[model samples]
Target: MKLSTRIALWAAAVVPVLVVLAGLLLLPLVGRDLRHQQDARLRDRAAAVLPSVRALVAADTRGRPKVEQNQQRKVVDAALDSGVRVTAEDGTVLLSVGPQPADDRAFPTAPGGPATVRDRGAAWRVLTARVSGTGANGGSGTLWVSEPGGLAGDQTAAVRRRVLLVAAVSAPVSALIGFALAERATAPLRRLSRRAAELDPAAPPTPGTGDGPGGGTNGGTEGGTDVGPGGAPFAAVRSGTAEVDELAAALALLLSRYDEQALRTAQALETARSFSSAASHELRTPLMSLRTNLDVLAAHQDLPPAERAEIVAELRDDHTRLLELLTALGTLARGDLVEVDSFGPVDLAELADAAAADARRRHPGAEITVELPPELRVFGWEPGLRIMLVNLLVNAAVHGRGGPLRADPARVTLRLAPAGPVALLTVDDAGPGVPPGERETVFHRFHRRRDSPGSGLGLTLVAQQAALHRGTVRITEPPTGTGCRVEVHLPLPDAGAPTLRLPARRDWITGGQRGDRRP
Candidate 1:
């Protein structure tokens, strides 16, 4: 059921019950009030007839029949509707008037306020007053005045009937008022629902830092507006009502999260496609070479030992190439799909040191030098940064050797330091440098020199890691003037810095160098 309808039904069910309960509480008080008024009336009647009662007692005691009769008439007149009975001090009844029990024995003997006295099946409020005449004809006696007890009961019954009528009438009236108010209150929520329902999740989110959708850097919609498909605004309703405002804010946040997830999902799908395409195209040559070598070994079982050894070496080279290509592609895909939550504080100098140590072990003939600080930390993905450092060192060791006229051992220098808000790292090589015209193209996937023995993805991995960390990478001339230097600048961690915002466009493996641009 709708919220308004539920509220209305609850009001209808509860209001009448509350009214009935209030009536139950008031019933006793009403009855008591009525009884008090009845008692007051009986007291007044007893006072009015007291003098006449005294005269009647005196006349009867003196044996004057005419006087006694006249006083009896006066007593009856004063008593009105209430019952009265007069008794002489000598224990003889002087007069009895209005409603009364046949025997006066049931009357209250004490002279005080009115009290209930029952005779046979009837009840009465009786007040007793002691009267005495003045002067020569002075006499004493008791005067009893009472009204029917049912008077207060009848009044209380009428009040109960009226209360029941009110309770019955309030149910529907209260329900209708409650429904109307509830409907008015929920109008904003209904509008919010309609606007939310109109949103399209597949539409690309407005870029937070670009001129996309919501207009430059305002994050798609300004103020409290959310733009849906076709640029229609899903206005964040902020009625003065706290509940409605809170709900609207929650809805806006939910939509923002949905857009973020949708973008991430699209990126993941693109990465998958690129991974498949690159693997298929790049693995074919090595696989063919491996197959050809295997066929030669199978067909030439009686070939010379030297020739057989050459064939086996060729197969091993092909196998190594295949393995390196696959590993590079997998790492590229991981960088594309990485989330910011995986990033944390990493010591770049430590990673560079480790990479240099591994490079020394692998390329014992190469002369490697490292100039790194004790610690140079940055906020980044540790595995990715380590991969980047490893690739840089390996690339330098493999390609840093000179042409025929150069020295026997290759030379590579790794350095790390801080530059303002960024951590600067450089790898200098003493080999033939890349031409200036080709420096930009060298970072592209599968782009390598023809004579190079390594996978071309080494520099590409370096570039990808740079972009993922919101950093930059560029190739420049080394200080020696005869070789190349690759410089990577990564942002340093700061206590008051805002969270990193990764680039919205990530197409590393899919053939676009957009992600490598210096931000």
Candidate 2:
């Protein structure tokens, strides 16, 4: 049912019943009031007639018939419309006048105040007054006055019937009024519904889109009054009603989320395509080399021992290179796909120390020293952080042999300290430093020196991991200018606390890491 109709129906049902109940509650009070008024008037009549009644009784006791008849006339005249009855102390009937009970036995014997009595089916208010003389002890009688209850009762019933008619008439009238009011109240909601129904979800309003019909782009929201993202105007949802506005806002938010998800899906697809294309291009040369090596081995089984060993060594190098390339590519893909849930509190000191230890184990002759506190916490994905540190150490092992400025070969130092709120980790190597121009470029994919052994994905992984952790990485000359120092500043857990929040955007493989701070 329509809201207005429901309101009208409810009002019709309830209002009449309420009116009737109010009348019922008032009826008793009104009836009592009527009886009280009748009794007051009856008492007044009794007072006026008492003197005459007393006189008549005294005359009768003295045996004066003329005086008794004169007093009886006076008593009857004073009684008026109320019934009157006079009786002596011995229950001897003295005089009767006006309207009264036909049966004298029905009269109250002892009546001081007004009371209710019935004769036949009619109710009456009766009052009794003692008619005692000041000087004449000859006569003492009870004077009775009575008035019919039906006088007030009839009036009350008439009023009650009229009130009931009014209440009955008010029901449909109230319902019609209620329905009109309800319709007026719900007008905004209907408008909102109509406008919302007209909206096209597919052509959603986006930020910076042109204003369309009604001087606004009809996109994200449901109305024309409010401008949504891209400045598109919503046509109808928010109709100035609080409930409608709130619902419009909720719907807009939901649609906005759906759009964001769609965009993310598209980005994910693009990232996958880029990964496949890059992998194919990079793998072709190595695969060709592998095929050539295999062909040579198969064709020449009787080749000299030294030549065979040399070919085998080259085969091993190619195989190893291919493995490392695939591994680095896989790791980069994982970093790109990493979610926020994989992140947790990692002690930078502990992680750096472990990486330093591993580098020491792998290249014992290469002096690797870690100078850091027992624990400095930062929230990050463990595998990503480990990838960053491992790549740093590996880079130092491969290329950071001591240069002319420092005689020691492959010596590296890692230092960790707090720089305000961020943890600063600097990996210093004792080798010829990276040039100022090439520092940033080294983090780009497939950017490597001609003679570089490993795949060029190592520093790219480092950059991706740093970005993933909402941190920054920079390459600069060390204090002595003998080697390059790569500094990574990760916003630390406040006072050894871990706060894991990933960056807003993550497509490191497809979209390059744009926020790497350079020095």
What tens digits encode model 2's per-residue C-alpha lDDT throughout 190-269? 77666556655556344323221112121233332443334344543446678777776765665555544544455567
Q: For candidate 2, report its TM-score.
A: 0.75
For this target, which candidate reaches the highest TM-score against the unseen true structure? Answer: 1
| Reference-based TM-score of each model | 0.81, 0.75
Q: How close to the true structure is residue 90 of candidate 1, measured as C-alpha lDDT? A: 72
Q: Residue 38's C-alpha lDDT in candidate 2?
A: 87
Candidate 2 contains a number of clashing pairs equal to 14
- Compute the lDDT for candidate 1: 0.81
- Predicted candidate 1 versus true structure: per-residue lDDT over 189-240, tens digit per residue: 8888888777765566554444221122222335776555434456676788
Worst 10 residues of 1 by lDDT: 211-220
Model 1: what TM-score? 0.81
Model 1 CA lDDT for position 227: 51
Off by over 4 Å in 1: 44-86, 90-106, 119-122, 135-137, 199-266, 289-315, 401-409, 432-438, 479-482, 498-506, 515-519
